[model samples]
Target chain A: MKIIKFTFALLLCATISSCSSDDDTENLTGKLGNIIIKFDNGVDDQDFIFGTSYNTSSGESYKLETLKYLISNIRIKDNNGDTFMYPSEKNVFIIDEADGNNAGEIWVTLNDIAAANYTEITFGIGIDQDRYALGADGQGDFLAKAEEEGMMWSWATGFRFTRLDGTYSSDTVTDEALNIHMGSVGTAVDNYREVTLSLPNMAIVREDKTPELHVKADIAKLFDGTTSVSFDEGYSQVHVDETTTGVIANNAMDMFMVHHVHND
Target chain B: MKKIFLLASALMFWLGCAKSEIQENYVPIPLEVEQPSNFPDIVYNLDNNLVTEAGFELGKRLFYDGKLSANGAIPCAFCHEQAFAFTHHGHTVSHGVNGGIGTRNAQPLQNLAYQSEFMWDGAASHLDFQPIIPLTSELEMGETLTNVIDKLSLDIYYQEQFKKAFEDGEINSENMLKALSQFMLMLVSSNSKYDKYVREEDNVMLTQIELDGFETFQNKCASCHATDLFTDQSYRNNGLSINPKLNDEGRYSIFENPNDKYKFKVPSLRNVEKSFPYMHDGRFATLEAVLNFYDSGLVNNGNVDPTLLRNDNTYGITLNEYEKESIIAFLKTLTDNEFLTDERFSEY
Candidate 1:
């Protein structure tokens, strides 16, 4: 009778352990979730708006009619230093200012992300050479998307990494064309840049949960960060010029900051 | 219990096989693009959008279809006629939808797979994206990409073609552009008399005059118009007097670089005989006029190509009457009748 009782106890313990093990596996493996990255554009302390005038440190006031840029190659590093790269096929995005909500926030929702505590987010400001070399087939819908947004150069086969089309007023000129359409000039010059922002706190993601990350992009830093370029010195119309574009690209790198994260 | 487990396993295996069979429908038939013996390596990366028979046919159909244009009457074939080696036959600058007159002359569509860039200003960097310029230009097709895709999506023919052409085939701009690229990449013009003679095919040999012309071309014009492709593919200011009315700034307008002012891509003289009037603006009416311009009509444009500068500080090639005639003979040898009359590329 004692032998039978011992057998029963062993069987029950094994059953309980197996059940808990299965539950642990379900929680740890193949649990995919979603993440929303909110891009908030601002000119210094002021929120960016269409046709709204903003002053720059270089003694120039500017108002934008069109503002958009390309973002690509998104990746996130977990707390354990394991990096989770978004699928290359669908990683690229265009952040058009016109597509902002009433609160002036543009959201990019990334789905099928691995459930983990992400510490840092990294992304490219423009199309990279590897993506460009893939030609039209690799672009999928991005080519048409970029073209429709006017973030692509109609004349050249390249993405306009950053497009700030409007007018600028200085001591001499008032509301002259301030087209800052900067991009890589084919395979010769590469204006693409990568920016990595460390999250203020760990962003906890779970299978049933969707986390939101708010990133602030200071537009004024594009002109005055690292290298200070004045509008009067022919910096108003920025296109494929290596010096001017490099300056803008470098400055754009310092523009983004992870303001906060919501683990909801 | 054993019987029940066996039945469940069999059911699972059957379900897995059924899922795989459904996915097999999208398996693509890979098509290879031919590389001519005498030509340089193709610049187009074909690995991304491998050429398929269905895709090429769909592309050919799109090329001839006028539904891509806003007016629904102008097609790519309107300006690019196959008989004239895919150039606007007589127009200095071709007209498009709603009678919109374009500024630059229409370039021939030949050997595009080998070219890294497109347009006289090298505007487009890829063959697949080249159509966007003409398709959206107000002076060309005058249509937006979204409208074109929407129009194409409505057609039952395109819907079926898209399914046959691509695995993930939705009648979207991506597949549409890929189909167009597959067609353009196959338009190789390498069967010219010159090519045949060089490749030692068909017992072809150039006559004495043509041979002499080739020698003169080698010594005089080979620097810019180099290789079997007939162009080094460099942009240069070839000393043409600027047409102030048009004020076309050439490649300088691309980046606004002062050094690039008045520079235009050196055109391939593949079908130069049929593709006229020649030059970027189509200024020269005949081959003789073009030769004459190179001989004496060169202007002292500030950014003129340094290679064109003679010891006497002149910008003209010292070509006599006989040299001109022979060069023209050699240039005519580049006319590939096989390419011009290929039924595959023909509209009718």
Candidate 2:
């Protein structure tokens, strides 16, 4: 009887210990930081329009009823030069406002943000080539949401890598469409743009906490040297015009240099 | 101790009996279907709905029942006739419950598993989400989802089917959509003459005229209508003149881009003979009309595919009378009668 009781007691203790260990593991939640994205529509900001269209020499004048895109594959640099990239599983950031204008601010919660003074942050404007090439499943939050949000065009052929739209004037018409749609599917022209963010040096103090990352988007820079062209008179649309394709490709490439990469 | 042991045994046996009772109430469905050898496996299978004879029968009954429709005269089977490749015949646009017309042509559903996006504009990207648009569209069903659920909830027959198809016999939007998806996804089409020719599974032969037509199709139309599956999965301005009445911009409606003006997804030509009145607006009544539009009727403008536009403002691909006939003959090879008459998919 004593032997049976001893064995039962051992089994009970084993189960209890196992349960407690699970509880201890479950209690360990990771630290995270809030990311705020602010769109600076402020380079001569008088009702700034950032859109894609077919009315401009660039292609067409397009207005954004909705302009939410994915930014993922994030890497952060500390003051000591130690860099850490967020796990590929869930790294997506979106800044979108319908009605053809930037709403100025967006926010996302960053996970597993260890306590550190991060000096610089870098992330892709869209999904990277590797992730894009990895085909459907490698695409996580950003790609999935962009798809769900109707941003990603039917797989391959081409994706609207960047969409900028507003009214412009050609020689003949005033208030003509100035649209730039830059996308590349298949070949090297794949339109996923990589954008790095440099945060304005600010300290976020927490007991085992990381600072909040603030990224800025300048809507004015999209059409810095671009103008609108009229489709009614020019007899041109997206695929037919060299000017439209050139401007779109150049503007998307221009995004890399315009963004400042930093973390505070 | 003996009494307690006996009690525990009785408890175990009673639990087993209770589980068996649950089984007696719930019917399991068979999940057998043709999984294509070359193509990838189907991502979603109706394991929950189960493929039991009873479950499919119930689903078919629900599909054909006009009680789910707001007007009670229109059923799911009304617009989607089994005879016409699951698409309405001769109706340019599908008429809804109260004589309302839908924006785009009602696409004939077949080999839907291979489709990456749904709708002519590629709005609803998933099969699961596609039904929501039809069910909620004021023109189509004219009935709210809640009304359908409530109406189905009251039925004893549906209740039994739901019990067998889902856990605990619970009926909700998710399960309702899922059940519909199960029924619709099973509407697979792979036994066409074209499919057999490609598979080399049949001793079928094409005449020299049909061969010439096939060559013409390969040169002129194959870029959009690719082989085997028959769609390049891209939206293009197929030189269709916009209907002033519809004012449908196709992809432009979704993206709000003037560049995407008049661009529509290339429809698969798997069973094109049955899915007549081609194009987004269903303007053309016959395949000949569609070919004629491509042959010499493409309207000239910006965003039109360069291949379709001629230097003289006319569309490209001017086929002679014999060539037109041969092309039509080649197109007829795509018909899959077995798909339309499959006993597994048939309501009866």
Candidate 3:
């Protein structure tokens, strides 16, 4: 009986010492990880291709040589309803279709994100008025970046939130100029919009892992979403017109959806 | 007990090493902007971006540096010659890299700290963002912000200057623009003969002709060109005949509002004598020509400012030859020789 008790005591002492040793390691309560947002562009069922014709709901066919837009203020909601916002200074990004890889996927890698199980993601389609009011003081390298990308107006002092430069052919006119350069007219009419998308599954982010969220953006919805603007009806050349830009901005909000998540 | 203590010591040592790696080497030295007693409150919020000696020096270097252009030859100094109050002297429209010609005449760069908006049409809302327009315009510098940053990063002088000027110096756009602002904010033109006469300094007084011209100006031109700054900071249609070739719609293109058609920002006449070939497109070559145009050449551009309306249903100032000559004399007194020859802003 004494021998059995000695062996038990030895095992208990071994377990206690091991537990104490493990407690001496560093705690990771507030650690940072990285997340990749893969933007996949599509027109209806087929993938988006430059200079390829795509038919709209209004019987007007169009082909784009350039397709780009600005995305900013990215934030993700945790499973516990807590939100983690990326730093405002570096949150703005230009998702140019020309910058896509061979697989036609434009990947925006966000660094230093708080480690969490994110359930939903929210982002702005264009620059918000709050950011614009801050002026040059708020923007770091984004002003110059926007200018380089031809996403800024030369005559005016605002960004081209969505630049779709191409030609469209209506029933009456064939191969006419189609430039949908929508943006806020200074502090007057705001075309900025925000969109929130629910994830298909929880994106489990850890220090050693980088979870990728594949987002599918339907280009068809930009013309046929909530507003359903017609090309022949003054929607082809949307510059600073309040009514035309408002319809496009509202439609752009409904274009994004979380297709899948790769928690690798 | 000894193993637990040892493990704790090891963890503490690791954290101590990590903390030392992030230790900052930033040291700040303050530089004050000289505010002229006659000028209005500065529009630039200096609190957000404090000026420093190193930052000002860096800005001067970047201003003259040709690397800011696409071809590495046309710098900001190419168009903004200091002798002409930072304007392109003798050029109706400034030329840029690759034979690119700009549309509007180059605006002067003095007393910018007091003004809220920039450019002929008030396209640039802030002082810091004003450079981005010219820097990226294809007919101006024709350079991207990223390319300029990359080029400056490779230079040894900029690398060191950026470090000394900013705390978080990374040779980025923010530091570059802030440094440029520090240099520009220091440009104050407040020592002209007119200023001396108004302040009653050094027994300076305007001659009879200049005094008469000043009175005439106060009665006729003071409504739009109000204040000592010589600008009411309002956009107006001056009724100049629109050029068919350019067809520059002015401020109407900004918002596409029909009401804002042909309206342009009223320019400050601080160095009106030196900043000749005036107006947005440099159409008028001399002060006499500008006065004649206002007196008789005013066209009904539909959106002409109602302030210039006369009793005869005409839009003009109705100035006689003597009034024009005297006003020119008074305007000449506004040329501050000290600001024109100030070595602080000199490229050499």
Candidate 4:
């Protein structure tokens, strides 16, 4: 009975030590993993669908036919405050509403993420100045992809960073154009914005495991965000104007939030 | 035993050499692209994309290949012919795949490396991204970049070409564009009579009429058509009557800037003798018409150039019949026949 008890104690100690060693060598294992960021677009509480009428805070009703925005410079901060930035060449992504699944989830899969326990993610809303200034140097398939997606203006080299094409009904007028095609125009007007969201759960990335981050984009905040805009005014037809676009871009910065995370 | 080992090593060496020659036939043979003395410093960064013989050949093949288009026709060479300095010969507004007519006249391709911007309205700031405008244009080649990449990926010849041309050997848009740029960078047209005369090469001399026209051009036209490249590289309103049907707003459509209406990039006069139907829309058919319009056909088109403002409150560069004739004669001297008939740029 004593021999059995001694054996059990050794086994128990071995089990506990092995688990503690695993926790200690969590990040030092030198294994790479994958992280999938599923962008779930919503208008307040309801899921974003094409031609769905969503009311704004400014007493305006709108429905979108087309919606696409540039998302780039994706980075994640670990619990220990180590930031893992995605590779620059493969970082930029276009989250088109038309490219989304039936569940309206636009998946941006980040490959070769270092194994760690991530707590926060920071990402930019549009193509930044550095990527834009490179022109055709580092741009590979992304330029063609952007051209095919109508996210680029045909006449110029500038990209339409956020294309929101729809009709809005205000107090004065009926369904008119609400095209908020805002973007930086050749080093002159920069509208790029970044957002940092703290994840609700700790995303433990391992070699054999895949983690998913569901980020909800409250698109209603675009019009009724930090600066409430009225469609009845000249804010309906937004393009590359320095003033109007600045407000829309500032409003768009507050659109995203980390809804949930799953380490699967 | 030593003899047996020696025989085995010799066999392996022979096999390796033979395999390279047959299967993967590629050697990085650097091609020399000359920069003429009279021309400005090269704007294209050559360090990023070095021109090799294989790369240039691949670029030329791709330029002439009809598979780049939607209907298996209309390659870049379809519109840009080598004989006319790469302009569509006798085309006012060039037709594209499926009989689709374009809005602007096809511009001549020469001295592209020296220029900062491309297209009539300065649409393409970089020569690398210039092909995208026409490749995906509905009224042009009408093929998506993805579709073209897919088509190129399917070809065995292209597979070999990509392997020979690029370091990574990937049949992608980046390599394709780089290959095309290599070919275009090599298209140097610095052997014209004007170029020869300026450089004092081959004991070339200009006639009295040519010299007289050169003087007139220097006095009046040289302000906008400046330098040996023959362009100040500035967008201007040249006082052409608007074509109401097309109604192209030029650079104004870019930012909707009211001041930029009817402004187009001043084209270089190099190879201008062959690059007619002139103007942005190819409205004029001859140098005579172009000269006459400059002399007397100036009309107020809202924002006519202040430099073109006359003492009589009209916008024009006043010129006599002889001055006009001499300017045309001088413009003809800018034609480089060596570049026109160069076998390197030719499809045949």
Top of the candidates by TM-score: 4
Give lDDT: candidate 4, residue A213. Answer: 94
* TM-score evaluated only on chain B, model 2: 0.85
lDDT of 2 by residue, B71-130 (tens): 877777777887778787755567688747676778887777667788888887877677
**Candidate 2 C-alpha lDDT tens digits along A1-264:** 766887899999999988888833533224445443333222221222233221223433334333444566777776667776887877755555442111223445565565455666677665567776776675555556666555566666434555544455445565655444445554455455565555567334234443444343434345543443344544223432445555544454343322332233
Give the alpha carbon lDDT tens digit for every residue of B30-55 in model 4: 98778888999889888888899999
Please give, for residues B143-189, the per-residue lDDT of candidate 1 as tens digits.
99999999999997887778888988788888888999998888889
> Which is the better candidate, 1 or 2, if ranked by TM-score?
1
Could you report the DockQ of all the candidates, in the order they appear?
Answer: 0.01, 0.01, 0.01, 0.01
| Each model's lDDT | 0.86, 0.63, 0.86, 0.86
The local distance difference test score of model 3 is: 0.86
Question: In candidate 1, which residue ranges exceed 4 Å CA deviation?
Answer: A1-264, B1-27
Q: List the residue pairs that clash in candidate 1.
A: none
Q: For model 4, what share of native contacts is present?
A: 0.00
Residue B136's C-alpha lDDT in candidate 2? 73
lDDT for residue A213 in candidate 3, whole number 0-100: 93
